[model samples]
Target: MSNWKKVLSLGLVLLVVAVLAACGGNDEEANSEENNEQTEQESNTDVNEEEISIGQINWAENIAVTNMWKVILEEKGYNVKLSVLDMGTMMKALESGDLDVSLEVWLPVQDANYLEEYQDTVNFSDATWFDNAKVGLVVPEYVEEVDSIEDLNEHKDLFNGEIVGFDPGAGTMEVTEDLIEEYNLEFELLPSSEPAMLTQIGEAVANEEPIVAPLWTPHWIFSEYDLKFLEDPENIYGGVEKIHHATRTDFADEYPNVSEYFKNWKMDDEQIGELINYVENADEPIEGAREWVEENQDLIDEWVQE
Candidate 1:
């Protein structure tokens, strides 16, 4: 109603508006600082400085092979980091270019579909690790008259109508499923970790109890346990596979020297087996592998020599 009263009300409204704007600005600045801090932390955690990062899957052989590569890369004076992941996650990471390399791509078996889908994003090197690498239903030596996958159908009662399996996404597990379906075998494929499955095999072998499982070669278990692969008369399981090395498409160009060494990497069963055994049996994998590489420097040099 009065001029002074109206002017005072207008000033009060302006003051409240200014305070609200200041509070909003402060909140935005705080959010900006938090985002920048997170970005810095992520960059610090990533191995991004001209270093070679490899992706390894869940398998003992994969661990052995990955550590060997890590050793070779370190010896060449380049930083290398390995991220252990499952096959599915590993493939997605490789496709998205988060992971640089995968040394154990068991072909026509695990991740076969992944390779086909992500070939453009990745380049698979020639099989760096190759062997019979067979996957089939294996039994302890005491399974008397059973000799093959087909024969298991008749003796299902003995094995409690079950076949031990490794990780669910494992190549061996995939093949085991096919074998069961193809042969019309009445057995449940129980998925478990490789160590657990192998422990079961060991116990079964010790007691001479009948056991069937998805098994592979060039594995230390063969040497540690007395077992035999049940004959695959139906041939449902695929034939021998060559374990390969794979890298993100830009890997060679991005880290040429490290790529060169990896491209030239190759060895037979004897050489790999020695390292495998050393890593698997020894308490310290990195220390054990490092010692093996140092002792066999001549062989390593031969592979990485320019």
Candidate 2:
């Protein structure tokens, strides 16, 4: 009786120990699976959290390129927001880290003041998109009387004693102010929006009247109208500038992929000109950008390649 009881008790104890060990193994496996699922979910959350805010000026080129990048980035599964800001506000936003990126910053000449002030706070792209940019007074070809900024005072009456200018704080307007002071021209610069300035210029040109306005290259106006940049003998208006993108100083660290895309971004006059023209004529700027992006998949692929 004692032997049988001992043997039975030993077998029962061994069976219980084996069953408990199996249960513990299953628990460990379940916990491991749960931890793996959580890690995968967190990684996906990080990907979904990748959002970028781009600051864009209302200038023609800036609008075109900013919209184009927005389309491209969104297509690549990024959340992109675009804000139309003035030159001063854009720079300040970049400095304060409110904006992630800006696609237009004319360097070595136009926008020099903003760049100088925000250099420490912002980071510029390694390469420029457009290298041949200019800012100056422009007129229709029919304005035969005024061929140069030096000739403006002689024909100031033609422009109604005021020069058509873009935004008040724009880089071009700032340089135009200096031009007026340096040339001692008897003309006033009327601070107007780009569309307003363009409307006035369009009317003046339509009537074969003379009109002078602050203008920039790579703009759609040059393609739409037979216009020419007035000569600046004094060279107050910066001759040629390279357009570069800028971002917050920490942008690259946070968004390495986007930073790489911007570094690889480059466009010549023709490409940018076509983009501006397309955007200017489209029903909406983003529509035009999407069209351009659709047609340029190969180029976009190169830019977004990791």
Candidate 3:
């Protein structure tokens, strides 16, 4: 081969190599930009997730329902948190927009005042469980002498002329005072929380002693003990009640999907009673709720609408 021919071939090979190297560089640069774009898109999706904070009240149904929502929201890729609070504090939190949703709000019976107070600032879903809740004076079936509120004044000494009541802010507590006045019963209400009141009832029932206290339905206590609501012909105890969902006013606008899910949520008496029983018997409410969510995927599917 001639020297000029060899030199020409070498130059041709070097030019091809240089061109391929430049193309490879461009390809690497394009790949880098593509990765960066994908990362940004995923980060934006993460930001779109709504962080839902719930004001879970101290009650069996509240514990079961709120934690159940926590599990469902988390499953749907939402950020969820629960704050265990009393009815008063929970209402305040909802009014201030600090809490996102609460699945249990007994109304026209136990939480009417709270509802009326916060109706302007907070939002409530349609009645979730209707005609299940009942609130009034209750006693163990063993207490045969006191079948009605009117009989309470006659046997006031049996109960020490004291009526066990629920939380100070509890609607039942407020109504019970009216009961004392309407019945003209010479009894003082012992203000306490739900758990404390339950403990009192448990002790009295175990001892077969005559005891009178505020009680309600959709409560695990009814399943655990035999109790009856005293006759209130005057209807001072009101009528059959329902449970509603409560959320912050801005929640729906901020997260439409979640709001829709809540709006469609409903649980019947048997469903909630079983859930409350599970939670009360489980190691923790959240743990039980997680298991319930897993076992009840069909129900969840029905709830999470488009």
Q: What is the Å distance of residue 103 in model 2 from its true position? A: 1.1
Model 3 RMSD vs true structure = 4.1
* Candidate that would win on lDDT: 2
Tens digit of lDDT per residue, candidate 3, span 1-306?
999999999999999999999999999999999999999866544335556788877777788888888888887777888888877888888888878777777777677777788888989777474456788889999898988898888998999999988778767787788878887889999998888889989999999998899887878999889999899978887888887888889888777777777767777788788888778888988889888888888988988865
lDDT of 1: 0.77
Clashing pairs in 3: none
Query: Candidate order by lDDT, highest to lowest?
Result: 2, 3, 1
Task: For residues 1-306, write the lDDT of model 1, one tens digit per residue.
Answer: 999999999999999999999999999999999999989766444224566778876566778878877887776566888897877677777778888888777777654766777788778786455755676778878777799777887888998999888788765677677767888889999998887988898888888788888877777888887788888776666677777778888777667656666666777777777888888877877777887888888877876776
The better-scoring model by TM-score among 1 and 2 is 2
Q: RMSD of candidate 2 to the true fold? A: 3.2
Measured by TM-score, the strongest candidate is 2
Clashing pairs in 2: none
lDDT of 2 by residue, 102-169 (tens): 88888777788887788888887758877888888888998788888888888777778888888878
> Which is the winner by lDDT between candidate 1 and candidate 2?
2
